[model samples]
Target: MTEPMRISIVLVDDHPVVRDGLRGMLESAGDLAVVGEASDGPAAVELVARTDPDVVLMDLRMPGGSGVDAITELTRRRIRGHVLVLTTYDTDRDIMAALEAGATGYLLKDARREELFAGVRATARGESVLSPSVATRVVSRVRADTTELSDREGEVLRLVARGRSNREIARTLFVSEATVKTHLTHVYEKLGVGDRAAAVAVAYERRLLGD
Candidate 1:
């Protein structure tokens, strides 16, 4: 019988020690291999493009660009591999942004070795995996908000999530700043959030905005 293919992985973390630790943990599994490594977002993108690994073990707050930025670029390029975020952050904003950027899974750095291993394998199989705490946060938010936003509200929130000011959003959408604020107010109400940051957080968690 032909040998089963080993799962190829690329590690992306700013710390060499962290990368070394993960490499040791992941490569212990006979079916998994660490094919490449990158210390920042730009290098991660370039490495992924060249190696085309089965999964990318990504870090969020790297120097060149964030993990979210890398994921967004990879999605734009239609890369075939999956991105699995492995980091210390599990805040609502962090989780939502990475997931919205097309990450296949999010696992905290503190996860048990077996869990991390399993999450990576699941991600490679096109499954969405979340750390337990992250799963809880997402489930709670998604269950509470069932009201879908109007197209304009979604557009407003998308710009907000991208860090655009109200005036900037108005200019981009060809609307007045007051109109932009009005749309944002409605978006906040619909998503049950009180402010711009919270609205973007919930919108991303609920997938109300296009990636």
Candidate 2:
């Protein structure tokens, strides 16, 4: 029988001790391998592109840089954006930022070793893995909001999620910049978000921007 391939991963965290622990814990799983490690966002981006691992196990709120920024950088560089955030933060802001930045999974640091192992594997397979707590919060928000984004507003927001500026979005949609801003304002009202970042985050939550 052919051997099953191990899921390749890169660990990114500011703390050496945490990275070390993750490396040992993950490698012990027998079906996973840590191919690289980085202590900060910039290093993490370079390492991920060079290594081309199956999954990236990232930590948010690193002092060197944030995992959200790293994820956005990876997406901007057109790297294989399969990032799984493993951090202590379970806040709504943290979760939404990571998701809008292109993370495939979110696992709290409190996850069991086995759960982390499974989360990495699931992330490698292009699955969305959210811890129970994160899942609850996401669900609650989704249920709380039923107002929908209009088709034009949704289109504008989708372009926003792709990192397009107002001018760029306007040009692409053949509309004036003022028109684009108006659509965005309506979107913000409907989504109950203040800015583009928060709007994109909530759009993903409501599944308005489909994968």
Candidate 3:
């Protein structure tokens, strides 16, 4: 029989009750283990270094430091763990910043117990998860950023919005598929989008393409 995947977790929250509750929930899962807890970002980093958990459930606004800062530090140090942000704030800036800082997932504190558990498991497996509400905010922010794109880039984005594959886009633009793919990459970076669906949604929202 295949062994169940073992997950070591660290909880980083300022509230004791929250930490305790999470620990209980996680421990109830046969394969999940709580290795340590931290009341602030600094403590979280220290505990993570010591425990070397597979995942870190990080709170955004802590007393000693910000979760984003912690993520930056951990990523810089090349920590071998996924950071799953668990916070009350779902602002676009916060979501984008966390993702940029190397967080594997973003989930609101109000998530259902099952959803939280699923997020932890998915993050441990290297999947990127974001709350639906947070995703909408991120889409909006990316759309806003598209206004700065050059005309050619806008053309490429419009083709992307129209559901054209890179090859099709290349044919339409009389350019190589590799060039089209490169343009798409630039569009994604400029819009801060990680995927084609997001790029299309942002383009539509910004009136860069007709819906």
Reference-based TM-score, model 1: 0.70
Estimate the lDDT of model 1: 0.90
Models ranked on TM-score: 1, 3, 2
Cα distance off (Å), candidate 3, residue 183: 25
For model 2 the TM-score comes to 0.68
Candidate 3, lDDT over the whole model: 0.88
In model 3, the worst 10-residue window by lDDT is 202-211
Q: Where in model 2 is the C-alpha error above 4 Å? A: 147-211
lDDT tens string, model 1, 1-211? 9888999999999999999999999989878999999999999999999999999999999887799999999989999989999999988889989999999999999999899989999999989999999999888667565588888887888889899999999999999999998998888777777998898777777677756
Per-residue lDDT of candidate 2, residues 29-108 (tens digit): 89999999999999999899899999999999988988999999987877764899999999988998899899999999
Which lDDT value does model 1 have at 196?
A: 89
lDDT of 2: 0.91
What are the C-alpha RMSDs, in order, of all predicted structures? 9.8, 11.4, 10.6
Query: How big is the positional error of residue 172 in model 1, measured in Å on the Cα after superposition?
Result: 40
Residue range 1-211, candidate 3, lDDT tens digits? 9998689999999999999999998889888999999998888888999999999999998888999999888898888999999999887778899999999999999999889999999999989888989878877776666447778888988877777988898899999998988888888887768999998886777676654
| Residue 54 CA displacement from its true place in model 2, Å | 0.4
